[model samples]
Target: MHELIVSPFLDGYLALRPGHQAGLRLPEHRYRELQAAARTEVPLPTWFAEIAQETWGLDIDGGSARSTLLVREPSDHGFSRASWEINLGCNFACKHCYLGLKEFSGLPWDDKVRLLDIMQAVGVVWFQITGGEPTIDKHFQDAYRYAYSLGMMLTISTNASRLWQKSLLEMFEECPAYRLVVSVYGATEESFDGLTQRRGAWKSFKKGVDAAREAKLPVRLNLIVTEDSADEVDAMVALAERWELDHHVYTNMTPTIYGGPESLLAQSSKHLRERTPFQGCNAGHTFFHADPHGKVSICKVGRDDQIDLMAEGAEGLRKLGGIADKLMLRTGGCQGCQLSGSCLVCRPLAKQFQEAKAPLANYCQHGQQK
Candidate 1:
């Protein structure tokens, strides 16, 4: 038992175990199943089976139960949802950003309608709009207005660079139902500009933050931690306190930039190695991101197109929940993992990649997980 406990695989997992993940211990059998599943052109079936065998010691009855579970079951009345990279456009070029340097061109009127209709049909009570930065798009106000019209909780994920504009400030005031989530890369201008690589972004960001506070809009602040700026955490906390805003500081993961892995290894913090396997991550269950390309994924981190939303619509979107169900059964190296709550496990890895790669590392306590 000590040997098993000492093994790095199960290190953090022993503390807080998930319901489906506890007590199951067929490592060899699960390994074989996972291997077989990996070889298949489409491994969703094998993935489902692997999870069932590990979690319940029971078969999934040929994936039918899993499929039905994903589609028919409405866990929390479809309360939360999100859309990602609507246009691949962002004004700021943050080194730690996953979308990386993509600019947002306004979505065509038809596509915008399709997205709105999807939200209305899905009964998604809460939704987030994100991109390289959703506010950078010229029609960002339109996006907010459309979502607000549906009488749903709306949130925006942005760098807060553009919100300094007076026009944007007025629009935010009109929409009290909306929340603004700003990402602060560091505690000071020098630290922040170093990450964003923009000369005056720090000032613009502060102005935007002030605008949101003055407008009385609900705002959540995100701090992306990197090797360069990690020491500023206490300062960031102080800033959050001073501003009276809810804050989170997350480890940086390589941004999924189209160009290359420029900061993947460089910017990652010492905390990355200390992190234990993820546990209790309910991304798909709590919130999901559907990209403009119609790929339904758990978050921007584990973005994938295997579960195509365009083909299946709301039903397809719900299929992502199946992926989450399967991940709960993944426990061998990950069970009782401590760092589980420290990172965001985007569902696409369990659904498609199956490689146990770290989820969104940039997320701190507030973005998701505890």
Candidate 2:
């Protein structure tokens, strides 16, 4: 039987109401406000019961209820949080993009509206807009306004080229929850333009970053390391400091499951520069991805007939719990790999291991942990 539990914040809200009635205190009233509307009245016990029921969508009893006493579920602010890889169209022909095809094809604006509507219905408060470049979307301005109307906190990842217009930055003045993340491929135009293969993109990106900063907007600097630019990490970090921005940098590997892993490997840095920590992975627990097709998968790389992401919604992540156990228990190529600490585990890597029946070679031989 599946277990059920109440979120701590939801429980706290339930406890705050009168024993006989469920109510929420209004910020202005300074008194309890009844949960009853003209049509429906909710009692404290039943209100808590409904929330628990919604969380797991399962029948819960005293045994499950008692377990809640041992722990408090994380607070549920009731803000729907979602991230979208909006479109595949891009200005740069970057070498590392795992999705090889570059085209303007994307879900129509109407479909996105349906998605936003679904998020609002679920009380999602946060939304992340990602893409080939969100700024380049012809309908982005409209999409942003629609999401803001529904009370969503927005985060966007872009190359930061198209948003260089001061007018564009000004449009965000009323939108406070919006934060822009600009991916800096290189520290200088010489390094950056060479990698992006787009002339003047460096200048355009800097102007956009400066414009956003001038508007008093929060900004983050994101960078991906490739074999060609692996040596530039220090320079990139220094640039981030100069700009007074938060920095995120990671090495790239073509996802093994995706057919384009070869393409990604060609674009990524062959030399390993750093080692990531070895920990039991929490795939479905930490984060998940919903593709344009509306199908969810374990991690972004696990696209298969068995991983039905559409059915799970946010709670579907639970289906993938203890995945590390399955990988560890398997007596296959992944069984005795020395780079276990550095392996990018998932169905893709697992398939690679199974097919080759050998450990996937690490590009940076010298960089391997001894």
Candidate 3:
């Protein structure tokens, strides 16, 4: 018989079969006692015990049940979702783009398919396809079709400019993406072109959005807020409302992973001032990010630390487990800081400070308060 254990942070439950690692989601409120029980090798609370038996069909009282609960560690290559940046080439060059003027030597078409296979093999069900513009990839259709055939639930983050193309729209109509996230730069031509620095981009974007709606595709909008586009925030939201599409607004921005100076200039001071608790990042654990060149990392902002997925493949995932574990463990100036409740600094960005890179003016609030 297999044993069940709760995650140390109570984020989820882990099932320990002899050779396989599976995760189970449980209510957040029950995490404390469940984590304690799993650590001490004691019986689960009555509620979880019943849930395990009924939902997963596991016999809790079998003679082979292990005395010690096997808690799944972060280094254990177990994850259910991932974001793949197909390529770093975008048509529009937004000033506030996090990846500032970066270039990537993308993998060959065959390698892209292989990476998709590895993602499926690793139990990644929810696959998000993102890029400078995913639809612009030369082999975008081939890769999208292959992943769709594998029965993966796919979502795409795109600018929506090329979505109106016949070939791409046909593919979406056939495979039907789980969601289409259209990034809205501005509500009008002047505001849009001002941020993107591309002539006629606003017209192209609106055309693509209209085409997606006509195709009956699942679509949402991401209203990107920057100092240059702040005046258009209300108009952007109204645009989404007119289209009857759900929308989210992103205000905060960060510098490039390599610490580029251009990014510092683009960031908004007011947006960075908003404070939030250090609720811990889930990157490299529950989720992972892969760039165009097959370099995998915990997340885009923390891309400085990475593994070459092409050279190492799944083994690279195992190596990432240790890095993620260390990242989650609070150390250095962050240790025992009372302002942790309001501090926005995370481990990956904190690493930037230790390496003597200039800190974001907003992140300096921590030191200022101390």
Candidate 4:
């Protein structure tokens, strides 16, 4: 296993370890020096050895760190992060699911490997593997292993339904994830199973949670508050505390991927928090999203003018900054809104609310007017 991953991050270079949040920033010249050392199998720099020893207690000494260090080649592209949906298939049918059609289709093994390679070529150092439920995908193990072998720090967004499996636990132990973001539906079996529409799902989730805690895996809980689960928010927080993990509460609901308003009905209006003003992001500029079939988009919510990664490869990413710009513009119902400057939602998200024919108050400042 590699002890450190050296790669180009944002504007400079970074050296980070798997499952560790702290990282060392490397200057451009030093990064090039490390690249040369990696190519020639020379001993690592004394400063690097000292820092590694001081930081992570690694005993690199004056020996060649090349054997245990993964140094990625710098790319012409500025992309440093990406998210890939491994599959849309999931075990539970939750009411607030953003994906209306949770089909289980994904790339074949060969294509999956190729896509990972393409992402690597574009300097994707921070990678996230997500799905309607990634742990249940048949090819998830192979895909995750290959991605880890490439030395990209990994994060998985899962529902925790399969974390209890011995095979998965062992695999996760071998290749530690940076984090496992698990979504929690309800606090108890009765409410949980009822909300997911899957009998015994709550039991499975509890067992999985117990097993994960036993294994000491880095886990975080996402409390998805719906009308049904709203009353159990405190219980959910208490569960996270008992498990000794961090948790985030989400009360807002989004439209389904196909612009259907059904998911919005699950929103707990009483618990809805005010959204911060819309600020620009680095979605397509520094990071992008790829669907299971390799179609690339600006972000998860903004999916227009997708670039087919399987067809264009990494070179196609050059078109994304332009696509992101186009999507940022205020069009549709938003073009005429005078409150656009202070609108809480961005263009892509507002468009969804419009398509759903949601009441303006649900998303726009115009509706909040007296």
> Can you write out model 2's per-residue Cα lDDT over 129-223, one digit (the tens) per residue?
77777778787777777776654556778888977675567557655435677888887787778777788978988888888777767788887
lDDT score, candidate 3: 0.71
Best candidate, lDDT-wise?
Answer: 4
Each model's lDDT: 0.58, 0.55, 0.71, 0.89
* Candidate 2 C-alpha error for residue 264, in Å: 4.0
Q: For each candidate, give its TM-score against the true structure.
A: 0.64, 0.66, 0.74, 0.97
Candidate 3 lDDT by residue in tens digits, 97-197:
76766454588998998998877666565679988888888878899888766545678999999888898888887766778889998888987888888
Cα deviation of 277 in candidate 2 (Å)? 4.8
Q: Candidate 4 residues 40-71, lDDT tens each?
A: 77888998898888887879987786786889
How are the candidates ranked when ordered by lDDT, highest leading? 4, 3, 1, 2
The residue-by-residue lDDT of candidate 1 on 337-356, one tens digit each, is 46545444433333222232
Taking all chains together, the TM-score of candidate 2 against the true structure is 0.66
User: Which structure is stronger by lDDT: 3 or 4?
Assistant: 4
Off by over 4 Å in 1: 1-79, 100-106, 252-261, 266-268, 271-273, 281-286, 323-370
lDDT of 3 at 81: 80
Worst 10 residues of 4 by lDDT: 361-370
Best model per TM-score: 4
